[model samples]
Target: MSEQRADVIGLGMIGGGVAVSLARRGRVPVVYDIRPDAADHLAGVPAPLASPAEVARASDVVLVAVVDADQARTVLSGEQGLLSGARPGLVVVLLSTVAVPVVRELAETCAKAGVELLDCGVTPGDKAAENGLVAILGGAESTVERATPVLADFAKRVVHCGPLGAGMATKIARNVITYGTWRAVHEASTLAEAAGVDPAKLLTVIDAADPEGATLLSWQRMRLAGKPETRAMVPQVERLLDKDLAAAQDLAGRVGVAVPLVDVARKHGKETLEIRVREDA
Candidate 1:
């Protein structure tokens, strides 16, 4: 890889911040965006290009940071697409959060065009300029290596998960955990508030109980390996949860507030946990 910065094929929040980060390090990027005035915000940092093809023509590595799979496809295959002017062996790093299948499909498209493709998912969204993102990379080792020099310009941490689509898979799973945890917190807060426990104090108590976050760490560490232990614990856990949930349900009835999630969890907790029990275990 040359010392030149990779071109940026979109100038949205993440891409624009990445361009600024690269430029702050004295690596000016060739930039393009669908909106004609997108480059105006990053005046001194990016050299605006007419199209994705123009950006591809000027730089050996181009980062595509479009919004979705449809826009990603259009940027690569539509008129004025990057492929139109990309040289053979040009590295195309995808920074979109599309489906895993989309990454695989685009990898095939890049292969057919003699281009190297890397599925690179970044997190901490628009903070790339201040606190760089964690880059989740998926591709052949050679392809990942080819994009590393450029990725290092904007990413504080780069993890090569596996070959082709693994980055997006990791990202998707990451989202599930994030949003799912939020949902759980919301339910807990509602239940606590209804039961006359202050929600803020509830959070404080939770923090004190697991100051080092050992519970989540243990859960992650034993995710697949704790089948036998989990099976054994399920019965006891069910009894405890059912007792609490029964009290919670009674409180909710008195308070005239509905607790749909707690109700459902009470009814299905054992059945849900039972799925984790391995047949052999």
Candidate 2:
């Protein structure tokens, strides 16, 4: 989209949203997803359809917006993986939030294959990704710059957090804030319910009175606004969100940092990341 040649895969939400955005910018974008009708919907949009390997061969910049680290690994390492067709000097940008070690491993693997790997995780909801207002945390400075113009297709601000896994670490740090806060609200609201108070009114106080009330205010408002949006109802994968807290805890434990406040929030994330609720709305 940003005057860069690119190819994209995974068209469900992450891939589809980004491809549509890129196609609008007049960039040549080829897209593919496992779903048969995935690319069909966009047939006339000028976003060409290609196999994963074909997409790899057709574009200089490749951005992966898959579901998990395994999906990333498979896209690159499987028999039908992109690596089957990827050439030297190709930069693969990862936008998923995965463990630090996993990304580090990806970097090493990419190097041997003559491919460059950059962890450039984006922060924002589904809509934000489409509008190109997402925050991008990249690993290397040079890789960050090399990928920035291309990344600008779906991100307005592309920043280098530091090195290889630093982008992921930074993303982990930020999620420790949002996911942690959401759990806090869940617990606080639950406590109010058990204490003989209407949970909604208690939640209202949190919404209307607290300073950081807007922290996960959207999550709350959506749930209350009728059948909530699946995403706004729950910001991220439960346990995956918990892992961010765990990562922070591991870091804090090593640095001799006494994070009293974070510990309180950790309990909420630990317990709630596993809860499942029926979407009433």
TM-score of predicted structure 2: 0.70
lDDT of each: 0.83, 0.70
Ten residues in sequence with the least summed lDDT for candidate 2:
270-279
Give me the runs in candidate 1 sitting further than 4 Å from their true place: 1-4, 207-214, 224-281
Error of 1 at 269 (Å): 5.5
Query: Tens digit of lDDT per residue, candidate 1, span 1-281?
Result: 35854889888888888888777767778889988888787745655678888988888788899999999999998899989888889999998999999998998888888998999888989687753799999999998887888888889999999999999899888888778778778877887798788999988998999888677556445446657776677678778879988987888888777778778878987765553655665
Residue 166 displacement in candidate 1 (angstroms): 0.4
Candidate with the greatest lDDT versus the true structure: 1
lDDT of 2 by residue, 188-239 (tens): 4554555556888976776677657564555445444545344443546555
- How many backbone collisions does model 2 have? 1
Pairs in clash, predicted candidate 1 = none
